[model samples]
Target chain A: MRLAKVQKESYDEKEVLLHLKEIEENIDFKVIHKIYYPYFHFEFNVLTKGLMKKKITSGCVIDGVNGRGALIDCEPGFNQTPIEADQTIMEELTYGNAGEEAKQFMYRSASIKLKSMSVPVLALKKKTFFYRPFYVVDDGDKRSNHLLTIDSITGNFHPI
Target chain B: MKLDGVIFLVYLLVLLGIGLWFSRNASKSSEHYLLGNRSIGPAVTAMTMQSSSMSGYMFMGGPALAFQQGWYALWYALGDAGGAIINLSVLGKRMRRMSEALSALSPIEYLEKRYESPAVRVIGSVISIIFILAYVFAQFIASGKALTALTGWPYEAALLVGVGVIITYTVAGGYLAVVYTDFIQGIIMVLGVTGIAIMAFSHISLGEVNAQLASIDPTYLSIWGKDLAYYGQWGVVIGAILIYSVGYMGLPHIVVRHMSMKSTKTVKGAIMWAATWNQLFIFIPYLLGLAGIVLLPNLADPEMIIPELAYQFFPGIFAAILLSAIMAAIMSTSDSLLMQAGTILSRDIYQRFIDKRATERRMVWISRICVFAGGVIGCIVAIYQPPSVFTLVIFSFGVLGNSFLVPYVASVYSTKANNMGAIFAMIGGATTNILWTTLELENPTGLHPFLAGLIISFIGMWIGNYFGRTPSPQIQEAVQNAKTRKKLSNPLEKKISQDMASESKVISDFVRKKMYINEGDV
Candidate 1:
């Protein structure tokens, strides 16, 4: 699975920088990494007695540039290639582990199965990776400065 | 009390679980939170739309009206049965296409983009917020009354608990949780009401019911209520019918459902499902109320008839489910209204003006806070118990329809509709509705307040358009593009083989043009 091309972009570098400045003060931040954020999605078929088989979908979004992550519950488009790690300014891209997140989902489903008399079998069905364009910002001098990501399409700022 | 507390607690926990589950990702982006990323399926979409539209009135107010007026209540049901289909057929596919092309996140945002005016955005947003709150306020009051009746809890306690649960799920999970809960609630509503109606029918036949009604009064079976000779009954009948039949077009909460559908091709299946559901269930509440005339002849409060009958006819657990069905009716509508109110404040009000460059996370938090605040206000209003839930619901619905119907309909269908027309129509319609209701004017031509407001709204649009400036070329082009998009004639076909590659390419080109998938990208 790979990142998808941004469907739309209405903001430029200056607009992103201006939005970043509004939230933080007296600090100069530069785009440390211009990369797409990766959102990992997985669909599974869980079979149980009496209740039949039900499909459970789960996913998580990783900032790709800053390593910040959150569980995702949306269908993301996937029609483009992922960014190569070598092409970016950062030494290595920080991507959330999709397999770990999938296990968490399985455990949650298993906890519910414990209440019922039926044994549940969980099987992986499909996996997709979606990416939205983001500009990872950091203050130029410090090794551990605060990281902020700006959504390129809607020009919304997110602290990562 | 006849209701089981454990069953109700389980329902609340499941709803809270759903909210917590979806809350993890809801903060990722405003689009994901507000519209579920436009990936909802036809079944969920249809169920959500129907559930959101049918509110506390379906349980309490509707049955009360039937108890008071007999079959005259059926006129309202007649309008409601086909209202969703008419609403979707006229606006669903086209609005979905147009909203996507315009990149409008909310209904007000859509109107702003389509009409090309900031003034339209401000006015539309204000009107929507006010009327939608009124709608939510009605639901809150009904919830308090229903909870108090079913569980013997204090009105204030019931109000707080009910509104608290609704606000929790809505604020945490946003639109995704709202739709999922609505789907479950929709099933509960249909099953509960149908089960009760079937039980009532078994106890007493329709013929016997009619015979009992006739003995009470011949007018009970008439299309007109008490006295048929009080002016022309047809005007009042038409007014009631029109309010429900076409009135759905103006509702912001309902209209947003059209914009959030998975694809334009999903419209047909969604409409069919919605219409079938409406046909199966719309008249059940009214029928149950009419049946009360025979079954619970000595019932004290007409509004409490459904719950009272549920307990008397069914076992405790089954009765509790029916009681939950009433709760579902109130909660479904309240959550959606609360969602729209919060979206209006955060997206349209705060994001648009107060903080133009806020982060998506900040915006999501602000929206949750707005939903909480709105719920509090609804609680305050519900505590006061404004105008018997049914009347308030109808009043809110009528005023909303009057205010936005002409402008919304014109935006989608009329090439000649201008910004001026929309502005005047909204103001005029709202004004007429308010004035008619406040002044308590005599039925000048036997026109109901709703019908009068609708008539004035159209007149306002026509008058404004005649005097208003011409629309810009860009606006005209956008409308034209929306209208000319190809229909999804063959959405189910999978692959075209090597021999049919050319045909496949042609079909693909048509779909791509109409679909707008990953637009402006390779």
Candidate 2:
């Protein structure tokens, strides 16, 4: 399957390794593998009608694996080039389901920000499937083997 | 009905009404019924967690233990007071995120999804069903006792009525009813207990009560307990403290509260609510028991200390309200336990194994049947009155804590913990607790059964992990995501924005191009 991916603009393998070393020293770490995590990116043109009409542009991301929706302040650019996706990482949530979740998230956020009784009507401007890169790293220490993941874009690390 | 009985009946009616009111919404979907669509706010979440954790044990078993062991019983109280804080702070956010990410509706289902194994769910269902039923049975007995005291009904009659009402409301309203009722119960519990404390103090001050207790048996005043029964037993002391303090994490009923919270933001406000409520409520039961030693000298059953004291000090109406509070403690915990067991039986067992394609409506019916069946069995068993409330509660609670604590903590904190580890931990911990208690290991080895079980469970997890396969990439990723903090540091946020700048620019340009094309068409 072809998957659109976000280009890594900040952290590379060397920088991620350095970041891990800075967090925890004395461990011989190596990248075991990388996975493309799936997300649905959505943009909406929201219009609210009341005493005063309001229109705003909003965007949100729905996690394809979990169906969790989050309102994002800014949109991310896709690489435009599509890459081959491994069959194992296919998302369980379909585009329609993700879009519905994104719409709900956008509506809730708009209503809260506007602080109004009027319901907001959300028009879908764009919806696209995208993937983010995450590197899985493991320390070779036999005694206390440690596994972690580093975001290839943001350089954030968390224990696996 | 007498005035007291009338008041009690009114309270029961209100509970039933509330339960029936939510019945329509609860039946809409399995998620709605099982987890209230995860919309519970901070106050309700904290109170429900506490009220469910407190159980009838707080009103009856706790006071009874305090009456028997003297000041040393405060150790248990101390643990109870801190249990929610530790439970919420450690497991609250992570469990909420992980359970949702896994799309698990039941705690047992959460374990199975986290470990990626069907057998995990099977074993978890079995253990939880057995002990959770056992736990609820203790509540049934407490309910009978409380009702018998309030209305002068026969124990058998009281048991049936109490258990019947609990099952009715629980089956009707589902989790939302249970939680909202628990919030009200939590308030009633604190007020009733505080009222009794004030009246007890007015009759005889704390100093005088202590002095009288010492005069009767100096050991009653000692931290070592009456006759120094547990003196120098650091193992026992620590176990008493650990049982409630961290044990809340292991309970399926309590941990479900974390999953049902509105969001991760609920944790902070919940912790504060739980801590404040616990301090106000937990210590008083044990203290009331201590005062019972001086006041109700000829009391027949130690478990009756609280009820007996309330009637002795307060007026008839106030005492009846206090009885309602006692009943609240029992019903709140009982309903939660029943709801969880039903969820496990229906979601983890019936649907997962028995009927894979069961419809949502069918599953809800199955859940209700399971809960009703459990209540019937519990009521029948409670009629026999096998053991003291304190003993039964401690036994069931200890086994449960031993069984699930290790696996639960490992699920969020350790990525490599696999199915084998969890299976071993559950079997090892539960077995050790049963054996230690049955064999009277505490007397000979000075190790509390709970402590013994915990040690074996941890060791079992380590051993089993060494032999088990590591989790798959998907599971590991979920763990990582669950551990990620919702709020990023200022510098980290700025860095993330900078990292995505190129992507942002590309999206902006694409949008602009699309707008220009639309304008040209116009």
Candidate 3:
């Protein structure tokens, strides 16, 4: 089966290669393929009882393949073609109420002003869905295949 | 009836409430219980770090040393004032990123992953448990003393009350409760110390105080401590400073703060807040000690100097605040130590060894059990064989710092540091410190045991590296990733800074324009 084709490489390939080397030496890179990942960007307007307002922009990146949360360095790129992904997981990532994560972040900021403020008021200001580019590294023989994801933006790879 | 007694009771209730409030979050997952899901903000992070590090040592032991040795105490305080700053500067950002990258939940786990050896984890966990307990045991004793000073209660009764509160917060709510309570405690500590110092200065003139100290003993004002003729005075001074300054890196309870922060971006802000707190709070204790020389010279225990000064100088409510501050210091440290002990046992020992597939619920229960056991043991030790709080604190601090400093530093900053080197560093450092202290070798050696331990530990690490085994491919990769990760700065960091600046400006505008009214008054 043919994997998805990688269109744009905004991140430095040499830098990513260096980082991959750090995670493991002598990476016999059999096949390095770029897969576009998906995420939802969230901008929040946090209002507190101290009559103070804080505007925060944070992104929630979900691994398209695994359908789990990921920590990426930069926001997802605007232009990319989506490969085969779990539609249900993508819907949950984008359409799910920002209640859980927002509440956690709100509590953190709220406690700072908690002495003066009773409750934190968080309003979703903006949400955008975009795809991030990741280099999929396949190494070793067919029986002992290793997989690694290198962020195309910052060359940051989630430790396997 | 002393109104202060009522106020102190109120403080305890508030702490219990906070603990109960966080119990739900703590029970949700092992991560929440152990590290608050690493979602803590900069202010809370800074407060927890400072509050845990400062401890009863800063409140009672630090001033006591100053009372006995005069200006010489400031040598230790000087290092302490910069301890958090130095810790954050060296280990903050890198550790945060690396620990997250490695998915290490605790300090021992981090070392294990970094060095690629379960032996490192076992040895590290054992050392952490022993020293942390010793340290917490000292805090337990200090809690009793602080209570005795506040309420005129018997030592046993005070100990039970203090230990009960600490155990409740620690076991019931875990790390979230510890950090939240620590923030409140940190505020009280600073306010109480600053208030006491200001009142003491107002009550007595500096010139008169100095003159009194000079009359008592001219050496009290000497930079070399009470007796300038003492052997190895300078060595002792260097030891005192070095122990606190670099020792913080090795402290699992303190270093866990770096691991538990929301992100590496939060560190710069946390450092600013922590350094501000250190500057404001550190000198007050020594100053109070100096004032005690003139004010309460006939007191039996010098550690009670701060409490006596509070009662003598401040009003009833203010005295209660000061007493709570002392409790705050004791509780903040004991809880963190208790928490670390629990994490080491449940996560490092039980989960890793006993039950490899332990569920989150099971792990949380085990951690709470460990916390309770630690408290019981600490209480018994404090009750049965209480040592001088200052001496015990210094001893524990020295041992842990000396053992872990070389290994911890090597893991983060040095590429050549290996599992063998770390092993030797821990053994050499701890052994030297223990033998020197137990055998009373410091006097003859013309150096503090801590200094000797530190030196020997570094040498051990260096020599061991020569014969050290080559790193496994995975370990090499982890090291490389961590090192190169720092070189690639995340754009998210800059964006967060920009967001914070705009938020701060908005808050400032509201304050400056008097646009916000106190909802309380309304």
Error of 3 at A76 (Å): 14
Q: Judge candidate 3 against the unseen true structure and give its global Cα lDDT, from 0 to 1.
A: 0.65
TM-score of model number 3: 0.69
Clashes of each: 0, 1, 2
Model 2 stretches astray by more than 4 angstroms:
A1-160, B14-49, B87-106, B172-182, B253-274, B412-416, B473-522
* Model 2 chain B weakest 10-residue run by lDDT: B256-265
For candidate 2, the TM-score of chain A alone versus the native chain A is 0.81
Report the lDDT tens digits of candidate 3 across residue range A1-160: 2233232454555656665555456555432554444444454544433222223333333323222332222333354344654211123333464434433433333332122113345676666555555555555546545444554654444322
TM-score of chain B of 2: 0.81
The interface root-mean-square deviation of each model, in the order shown, is: 20.1, 15.9, 17.7
Candidates sorted on TM-score, descending: 3, 2, 1
**Could you say which candidate leads in DockQ?**
3
The sequence of per-residue lDDT tens digits that candidate 2 reaches over residues B1-522 is: 567888887876786566445534444432243234245556555655554566688888999998998999998888877775677667866886686567664577788899888988898788888888888888888999888888889889988998987786565443223444556666676667788899898899989988999899999888877899888988898889888876655456422111111101213546566658756677888989999998998999899998888888878878888788668667766766776676677667987799987754575577677777788788778876557788888888888888888998899989999999999999999999999998899978988999999999999999999978799998998799778744433332222322222223223233345457779999
Q: Report residue B245 deviation for candidate 3 (angstroms).
A: 1.4
Ranking by DockQ: 3, 2, 1
